[model samples]
Target: MPPYKEGRERMKRKHSVWMMILVALMAVSLIGCGTTQSNLENKDTAKPAGKITIGFSVSTLNNPFFVTLKDGADKAAKAAGADLVVVDAGDNTAKQISDIEDLIQKKVSVLLINPTDSAAVVSAVESANKANIPVITVDRASNGGKVVSHIASDNVKGGSMAADYILKTLGDKGNIVELQGIAGTSAARDRGQGFHNVVDGKAGVKVVASQPADFDRAKGLKVMENILQGNKNIQAVFAHNDEMALGALSAIQAAGKNNILVVGFDATDDAVKAVKDGKMAATVAQKPDLIGKTALETALKVAKGEKVAASIPVELQLITK
Candidate 1:
């Protein structure tokens, strides 16, 4: 073979190798660009302004009813892929106020509250309003100020229902005692009014004793025991909540009085069982789960700049044997 021809062939081979390397480099760059674009598209699709956070302030998680309410809210929040931060006020109005302040500082997207006291929560609501955060009241109300919505049962009507049941069961003639809830609570006031409305003019139906039990079973028991010591002829006891009614039951049993009828509100599981066993005459059932779900939904709507009604009324169930 000739030397020049051999050298030209070698040069051609080198050029071919270089061309191959260049093509490989271009292919690698194109693949990298495609991967980057894919990642960008995935990010855009996965996050639509990220997730929302909701703050839930409950009056007391100590009660089974409130626990149910919280559970419902948590389930709904999880389904919506939203974050929920729950705080318990321990039935303290001051602590509830502080909890609301903390939620505001955290800059939560929305606020769901079950106030300890409606009047005491107004300041917190106003503060949230000033910060442009929507507030939804659940199972309670704020005394004054702007609240996006209130999700609760009609206490007045529930009270009336309870009163009617008591009257019918007693045959419109009996000596009764009233175990009220928390002093300042709307439930206590409204329910008491309802009972009074039904029993006021009825002949032979007398209110022998009345006292605030603070919606605590132990308190109710103590109050009832004291009343029984003074008035042995009490024919019935109406309690603002099941806890109080159960307490009254204990007191009545201790006094060896099995004839007195007991009516309660907030038909908790225990209350239902009591009714089933004939330990309680009747109970008014409030749907805590529905209240929680509705409050969260309303809060979301308000957060999204939608108009929500001031009050969302829930249904009541009359539970009796």
Candidate 2:
């Protein structure tokens, strides 16, 4: 063989080997780039791992009952290492709807609503539903929405208990004035119905006057005063909530009537104190804190794809002195 031909063969072999090495390096670089791009796409589409957020749209923080409820939710969220974003509606139905919309925009994993007005909050609930957000109603329920769960006491039973207390105390012979809560609310409607169920049929128990005080303490006093002007022979008063009952008590005390029994609902701190002091007759106990805690636990279960009951009822009892 010729020396020149051998040298040419060696150079060709070296060139081929270098070309192969370059091609392998380029393939490695392309594979690395593809992996990074795929990760970026996944990150953009899905949430970060182990992040769960819950939104709570409360009716009003001003009311002590609702304030306690919020505190319970906050406590549970902290215990579970979850995030809770709360918005207060101040008892305004429109504000509550707007608040819920904002929560949906935030893309919360779950939504908890304590509706100010059961009928008016339907649209807000439907909006959450359309967003594919699960909704759990606390304390108060929406009249026309698909709710994942509703957590509240049996208002009708509470009302019936109130009426029974009155009848038993007065021997079913008394002229009673009812100071009602806000009209159209489930609590108001159910409580009033329960009261009527027991009182309407009694021969001697008469509902001489029943008026709505909007669940305001001051309004309760004013309305009772007006009722007193016309019905001076009233023997008992039933207020839908503690606020109104306390108000009516004030009016009754001012009117120098000490024998009239006053029954109320929602045994709040104030109402309980009143009952202890014998200032008020009786009030139904609805544990708002338990309701809040149960609601949070249910939301966690639901967010994790667990099934929960459609209605969760907390225990209720009558508080009397």
Candidate 3:
């Protein structure tokens, strides 16, 4: 072969080899970029695992008062961009404990509890604390536990106010039956104490029978019926809640009893209507809507590691004809 032709052929061969190497490098770079983009898209589409979950445990949903509380809480939770899970204990202590356990298993971020029994709920509160979930007590206090906050009305003063209204209406002389709420609830205990304190030294007044109606209107009616079987001369009835007071009214009217004063706690809308209609003498109004709003607000603050007061007090009003 000629020397010029051979040299030209060798140069062409080197050029082809360099071109092949560049193509291989470009192919690898494209694959790497595709893989990285896929990974980033998967990461962006995946749902975040941890969100703020709040467990709201209430004593019962049977009453309208609690229904209002739940409504207020739902509104606040939505406003704060948090999730809320509500559990009703139905005034049963065991059920309340079970509900708390369920919330813990869900790994809720916080607990807002209105205990069935203040003393019985302490262990459940401790369990929440162990899981690092802050517990906020609403409308009541846990017997003994590290609670983040307590939101409740002034029950003691409200109870005393109701008692004084009854006394003045009855001329401080009457045989009254006390219809209490769930036995161990803080509201029930404190309100009962306040009522007794006011009527203790008063003359010509007696609490003939005191019974727990479990804060249910049906139970209150039945219990009042039983009480009326022997004590038809009863002049007044003081119920711990409007439902019980309404129940007492049913029994009173059914048994042809008239001119009996009926005073109640929790000035629910129905209770106010009854007072206007001359069925109930008075009621102590505890703002349940306010309690629910405060509880949720406090829970959000706690989740954010913000400072919250130990106690948030709600006001009480007296409603009567």
Going through the candidates in order, what is the number of backbone clashes in each? 0, 0, 0
Per-candidate TM equals 0.83, 0.85, 0.84
RMSD over all Cα atoms, model 1? 7.1
Decreasing lDDT order of the candidates: 2, 3, 1
Q: Sorted by TM-score, highest first, which candidate order results?
A: 2, 3, 1
**Model 3 — which ten-residue stretch has the worst lDDT?**
45-54
Superposed by TM-score, candidate 2 places the C-alpha of residue 103 at a distance from the truth, in angstroms, of 0.5
Candidate 2: stretches off by over 4 Å = 1-48
lDDT of 3 by residue, 1-321 (tens): 899999999999999999999999999999999999999999997646655778999988988999899888989999978899999998788999999999999888889999989999999999998998999999979998789899999888888998999889888898999999887789999899889999987889999999999888999999999999989689999999999999999999999896888998888899999999998898998988888988888898888889889988999999988
Candidate 1, residue 161: lDDT: 87
Number of the top lDDT candidate: 2
Q: Would you give me the overall lDDT of model 1?
A: 0.88
Better of 1 and 3 by TM-score: 3
Report the candidate with higher lDDT, 2 versus 3. 2
lDDT of each: 0.88, 0.92, 0.90
Model 3 bad stretches (over 4 Å) = 1-51
